[model samples]
Structures are given as structure tokens and as C-alpha cells.
Target: MIDYTKWDEYYDGGFADEEPINNFNEEYDERSELEKLEYGGQKTNVTAKQIMQETGTTAISEKFLYRNGVVIILLDYSKGIFDKWKNGRILHCLGDRTYTTQQNTNGLSIIDRTLFNADSIDKIIVRAFWKDETKKYRLVNGLLVLSKEKPYTIEENGKYRWVFPLSLMSKYNFQMPEKYSYFLDIKSVKEAALINADKEDGVRLTTLNKLARFSSSKNDIHYKRTPQKKIKYTSVQEKIERSSKIAENALILADFKCEINNDHFTFIRKNQNVPYTEAHHLVPLAYSDLFNYSLDVEENIISLCSTCHNQIHYGKDSESLIKKLYANRKELLKEAGIVLSEQELLEMYNNS
Candidate 1:
């Protein structure tokens, strides 16, 4: 019979370790030790199979951080499970925390606007972890969807996460499994204010409209509806907000005057120094698909007062207004390589 202790020592030193080290030129022990320290003493250093065998648990709690700020809620799920779910649709949210990563139910004031700007969309890499399991990562472009529910009245109360409603999930081609029914309903103060003043009258409309522009999302379109039985409407496309550069440039180009009738705004915005005017994409940004070039450029942007802008889209003679504007910009648009005729542009707007 072979001597077992001498055989074990020979196997460990010569065969078990030497073969892989010589073949791959890898320093597994050193790399693992470094990763162990980098991941904050987490158990990701162990293999997933080993972890599963030891703990008898398949699911893990994952936290996502962005620029060192917490942006994901603590959710329990396996990597394979989340990957399968994400195949349908991936959603993310900004967590209720200060920049210091401490929980703050009050608001997102402590959040860094530099990295997590509330006004614009940001692409973030989500780092997810499950108890002692190897950490999983995903890169997704996500936006903040404000909760419709009141924070104070809710049982948990105060700060909460953004939710993907079933309606929206279907729109995005994602379906939540029957077993998981959790949805977020938390909103920030700014979002709440905008929702509350959705249908403002007169002076309030100016502020509402201004706030609406600042708070609009480039990826999604939202609309308010009044109950009616006669009309059946289907949502076709998401609204894309004009770039800040395009809007501001248009305003400056028009010298703050209404492009249609050359009239100044009726009322000045409450805290703003400039007269209020809405930015209108001449070719309608919604139909941007038809053109090879971007519709969000300065030449395609026009400034109009609230009344004129609304009339162009909803009034009985909106077609005539669109034609007139097209006529005015045809040459300039031609110069910028946007060669759509007046009727072609009008049809594009109507279709959208």
C-alpha cells in the first residue's frame, strides 16, 4: 500500500498546484486576496458553487451604487434570476440616501446633483451582491420615475424607491413574475409639486410649464387624461424632451420673441429673469426617426409663446401654423441639410 501522507504532500506541491500555475501563469491566491479587500470583506472570493453548497441559499440581497451614491433598493434575487428577468426589461431607481450613503427620508437634497442630476438621465453600472456570493454587475441607462403615492401617509413613511408599474412594464415588454408583486410608489418634492399642479390655470400655467420643461424626460412621454367614453386613444411613442442646448439656443436666436407673431410673452415667469417662451421643434422631435440627422439641433428648434405653441399642436388651424413656420424655416432648414417640405413635415407631426 502507498504511504498516504507522503502521497498527499507530493500531490499538493507537485501536481495539484504546479500544473495550473505553469499552464496559465496566474497568481490566484494573490488576486483573490486583493479582491477580498476591495469588495469590503465580502465572500465573493469563494466560488458560487461552493457558496451554494455551504449556505443552501440561492438568492442574495443586491445593492447598487452610482458614483458612490446608493441608487438601487435592497432586493433579494439570484444572478441568473435577475438576468432572466432583465431579458424582458431592466429597471433601476435612485435610493433614498445622502451622498454620505446614509438613509435620509426627507428628500434627495443630500444626493449629488453633479452625478445624479434629477433633471437628466444617467447611465450607471449597477453592482449587485447576494450574501457571500460572487458579485454580479449590469450596465443600464435608467431614469427616475417619481412615485404617485404620498410619502407621509404610507405606513413605512418618508423616502422610498421608484417603481415600474405593470402598465409601463408591458409597454417596455417586461413582465414581472407572479411570485413578485412589489412596486415602488415614492416621489421627490419636485415630482410631487409637478403632479399636483398638472392642470394649472393662468399664472400658475407659466410656472407649471417652465417646471414641466425642466422636469421632462427624454426617454418617456407622459400625458394626463380626463374620463371620457367616446375617445379611444393608443399611445404610439414616448416623448423626447429637447436638449437644453437646443432649447436655450432657440430662445436666444428668437431674441425671446414669439416666432409666429413677434409678440412678447403676456406674463414674466415668477423667479426667472427672461420672458417665458416654449421651445418647439420645427419638424417635431417625435418624428425624428424619418430624418437621418438629429431633430434636436438649433436650426430645427424654434421659440414660441405658450399660446402660440399650444395652438400649433391642438388648434383647428394648427396645420396652417405649421405651414407658415415651415415656410419661414425652409431655407434655413435647407442650409442645415434638413430638406423636408412643408407638407412632409406636417404629415410627420400629424402621424406622431
Candidate 2:
């Protein structure tokens, strides 16, 4: 029997275990033609049609598809590998099947020609799928620059792969289905990439102010109340992207007034003509990896005047302000899957 728990072993061993294959094949063989085309093992072109339909892209190769000057590569997820040197996640697509001891030269040539020589292709969209603990497939989509480096070659059979190093461009990593579905809209992926690029290039405060108007209202905000699954740490700057929309909502819910003191005065902005309180993460986003849940949610964001915001970051006696903020939002934070004591929160600031 294949031990699903030991994915590392199963993957490294070339999936030689017979029981799971027999089981999977048996279940797969009974499905309708449409279902078979829609979902299957890595060898199957399962999501190709879905991608083409969603993006109006044409397949330049079996794995490389082209649409409007962009290349979208569909990859089957291997184990998560974090490259400390790159400070990002490295995801790969298994090259081709191996027969006996020899690698397929034809397969290697095709991949090389398709990807390596594509000078015109500046951006590549990567859509990867991995099965979760429940055996349901989850999807992670990101936009990346085409790497100039050659594909990594492995001595292990069936392990020759093309790897893409990815930087975190969005607040959320994987998109979970509302129902048991594997489809991710292509449009949403592109939009998110543009937003992240803008955030990286534009002024931080200006970007937030522009997006604040589009943020969801207090009544419309909802929390999953469950711990968010962590992606392989893929940040280029070691900083996770914060959701401007969530921060904006927090500011809106606070009536654009300082949570530290409602009487605190700040000049109104010309853009929105509201009080210019800054949205500060009370627990700080730098300590996100320590928690099971996300720190980017509305409940974790506090509206503070410029002075108070600066105080939390620079003042010697900021602990009292943190204590008051924590006390006010502890229950709400708990509901949003963030649980930390006042001392721990204070320590986060101190350490930073």
C-alpha cells in the first residue's frame, strides 16, 4: 500500500507503489470521457482545455501556452521547496517520463526549444495544482519573469524538471474552491499580478488611499475564522504583501478616526476628504509566520493617528498603547484566527 503521509518518499521513489495506482486507475477508468479529460494524473493534459477556454490562449506546446504576448505554463505541484538564497519559492514541472535508465532526448529538446528561445515572452503565468490532506486538489497561480537559467537536470528517473522561482505578489497564495472544484479564473490571476507590480513601484500611502474607496464596507466584511494555510515563503524582500482593501475597511469601520484617541487630530486628505488616520497592524505583519492565521485581516488592523502610528514603531513607551489596542480587539482578533497575549504583542514590537 502507498503511504500518502510520506509524500517525500513516494515522490522520491518515482511513485512505484502499485496499490494507489491500481486504486486511482480503477476509479479513473469508470469516469465519463468529459470527467476523464477534466481531471487525472500528471501525465494527463487535464487543465489544458480549461485554461484555453478561460484565457483564450493557444497551446504553443503541450505545456507552454501563449495568449496576448504572455506564456502560461501549467505545472503539477511537487513538494514545497524554499530557497533561502533566492528568498522565494521554487516550483517545478516534471520534464518527461523515463524508460529504463535512459532519458528521453526528444522530450528535452522540445521543452528547450519552446521555453529557452522565447525571447519575446517577458512574463510567464504559472498555474500549479497540488492535492491537499483531503485528496482535493488546490490551485496556486502566480505571474513570474522568464528565467534565463537552464532547467535543472536530476539523476533520478522522471525527475528532470523546469523550475520557476516565484516572488509573493498577492496577499493570499492559494485559491480554495467554494465547492470541490479545481478551476481558477485566468483573469483574476492577471489582475492580481498587475496590482502587486503597482504596489512594488508606486508610493505606499498613495496606493492605499486610491484602493480605500473600493474596499468593502463594514457590513460586507466577513472572516473565515480558520487558520490560513501558509505557502512556501516566497517573498523577495522577506515582507508579505498586505491587503490594502482590508486595511481600508478597517479605517472605514473606525470612522477614519484614531482608535487610540477619537479626539486625536489629523488633517483631512484631499482625495477622500476623510481624517488621515493610518491603518496599523497591531500585532505587526512581520510576525505572521509565527501564527497559524493571517495577520492581514481587518480585525488585526487598527486606525491610529500619524503620531500614534509613529509611536508604536519608534517611541520608548509604546507598550501601553499596544495594551489598550490589544484589549479592545482581542475578542475580534480571536474570531479572525489570531490569538496572542498583550505581552507577546509588545515583544513583537520590541524585537522589531
Candidate 3:
């Protein structure tokens, strides 16, 4: 077995001297980050499971999952690699009922045992998380199967496509957890090799390299014009302006509402399709904290009618009226699919 702990030394100057990235930006923090990665680190041999757990995602040169969604690994668990005691290196047939530990002499399959050793048989479980546009994550609703015939491929824009390694794409047979939030562990394994809850984060970070990205670049990428680098340059100013526009769009996406009661309605008789309320982003582009454009996810925006918008500036009678409006329209609110909790409404009010 490879000693993964030795990886710390190896990762000192890691990512096989770092992954290649396409773009080049000297003043960008991304460049600094790339330079700092495993800046002076060493590496250790780690298991595929360990690396996968650490980074929350991994792509292997070999295919592991098929296009139709199947899984192929139970990991080294069954091989007794995760057992607590080294001597009990026995194999367990599928559906075997009992097993014996090193402390006792008799051999049982999947029954009772006093001492749990390193050679104990166990199963491996897996789950996944994804990084969405805003650098926040929503658990994946479905899963894919991984098999020898159906290995997966890492595609551009960071998508995982399922395919076979050698020839044809194969389907795997395994049930994924209903929810994406989960952990994989060695089941029925010995306690010594078992990781405790506290150190799990460490294990994950050490093995997976959670924050590292492979930085790739094309060859013959020589710079022609020698422009001296300066941080004060206004080149990113244009980029910042564009970023604001995207942020505004994100606000509109999040705060979409049909009506805020007829009282606040615009009553455009010609166009009844228009919503009575105006949806907006909470963090106005005026705020400098947001840069590189902001994601138009739910957390960044909200919807309100003209009355509420005006009342936001002069918040008093409108606050009570808004509360009553929301309370009274609880059912109508459901029609628009916006039934915010009292606490949430209050938070929006406060933030606004």
C-alpha cells in the first residue's frame, strides 16, 4: 500500500508542477494563487478514494462510470485494506452471513465479532457536491452509474460526461442517495483505520486537494508587446462595468413576482402580462464589494411592488402594510410560488 502521508512532502511543489490554464493575467490574483499552490510542498501516494474525498471531485484518466449511470468500485474495503488488524486478511463472498475477528480464532462471515481488525471486510459508499455559478453549491438531484465499460469524462465548462474507457458505454447498477449531501465510508471495517468525525476535514483536504485547479495553457503563448504591469491600470474597469450588468440580471432572475396585490399594480391595461412588482438585486451595483460580476442566484435579489420600494426609503406605515399584504396574500402568494417565511420577509425588509 502507498503511504499517502508522504504526499505532504511531494505536494510542496505540486499538481505535477501545476495544471495548465488557458488564459494569462499577470496582475490577476488567480496567477498569484497558481504560483502559491504547493509552493514548497511534497507528495505522498494516496488512494483514489482519498483523493476523491478531499477535492469533492476527481477525474481519472481511466473511465469509471458509464454514460447510463453505473458505479464500478466498492473500493479497497473488500480487499481488507481498511481493516484494523493486518493478520485477518480473509475474503468474504457476496451474501456471506458471518465473519470472525483476529481476537477470536473461528472464522465467521458477516455475523458477530469482538475485535475489529484491519483485515475486516467492509463496503464503500460515495456521494458528491458540485460548485455552481456563484461558488455556492446545491446538492445534485440525480446520480450516474460507474462501470468498467462506462467510464466518465471531464468536459469543458466543468461537466462530467459518462462514457466507456475502451469501447462501448456501459450502464451501472447502484442506488444513489436521494439527497446529494452525504459521505462515503468503509462499512464493517476495523476501528483503527476508521477515520473519526473530527479529522474528516483534514483527511479530505489532504487527500483531495480541494482548492487546487489544473492550470493548463497552450504552447507558443509568447507575449509580443512588452507592456509593463501596473496594478493601477483601468483595463479591468470595462470588465467591472460588464460584471455589474450581469449582477443586475441576476437580481431580476431572483426577484421575479407576478403581483404584490392590485393596490401596487401598474395597471398597464394594454399589457396585463406585465408583473405588478419590480424585482431587484439587494446588493446594488453601487456597492463595490461585488466584482467579477455577481451570480444572479436567489440569495442576491428580491421582488417588491412600487409601494414597497417607496416605503423602503421611508419605512414605517409601509412596513406594517407590507406585513399585512404578505400575510393576507399567503394563498395568492403561493400562486406566484413565493411564500417567504415571516423571518425571511423581515430580513429582506431590514436589509433593504
Judged by lDDT, which candidate is best? Answer: 2
Q: Model 2 segments beyond 4 Å from truth?
A: 1-206, 214-216, 222-242
The whole-model lDDT of each prediction reads 0.39, 0.52, 0.29
Residue 318 of model 1 has an lDDT of 86
Which pairs clash inside model 2?
none
Give the poorly placed runs of model 3, Cα more than 4 Å off. 1-107, 111-240, 247-352
- Cand. 3 Cα-lDDT: 0.29
Please give, for residues 168-237, the per-residue lDDT of candidate 2 as tens digits: 2222322322223322122223444545543542344556766556345667765545556544545643
Worst 10 residues of 2 by lDDT: 34-43
- Model 3: per-residue Cα lDDT over 1-352, one tens digit each: 3232222232222224333322322323332332221121111123444444543444422212111121222223233332111111111111112222222334532111111121111222222222212222222222211112222233324432222222111112122222222221112233333234214323322322222221222231221222122123266444434333333342234233423344445432123333434433332222212123322222333455656656754667656655554565444433332323444444444443
| Per-model TM-score versus the true fold | 0.33, 0.40, 0.22
Please name the candidate that would achieve the greatest TM-score relative to the true structure: 2
Residue 213 accuracy (lDDT) in model 2 = 68
Which wins on lDDT, candidate 1 or candidate 3? 1
Candidate structures ordered by TM-score, highest first: 2, 1, 3
Per-residue alpha-carbon lDDT of model 1 for 35-150, expressed as tens digits? 11111110122333333343343322223333432333223344323211111122233333323222323344323222233222233212222221324311111222221221
Q: In candidate 3, residue 165 scores what lDDT? A: 22
Candidate 2, residue 252: the lDDT equals: 80
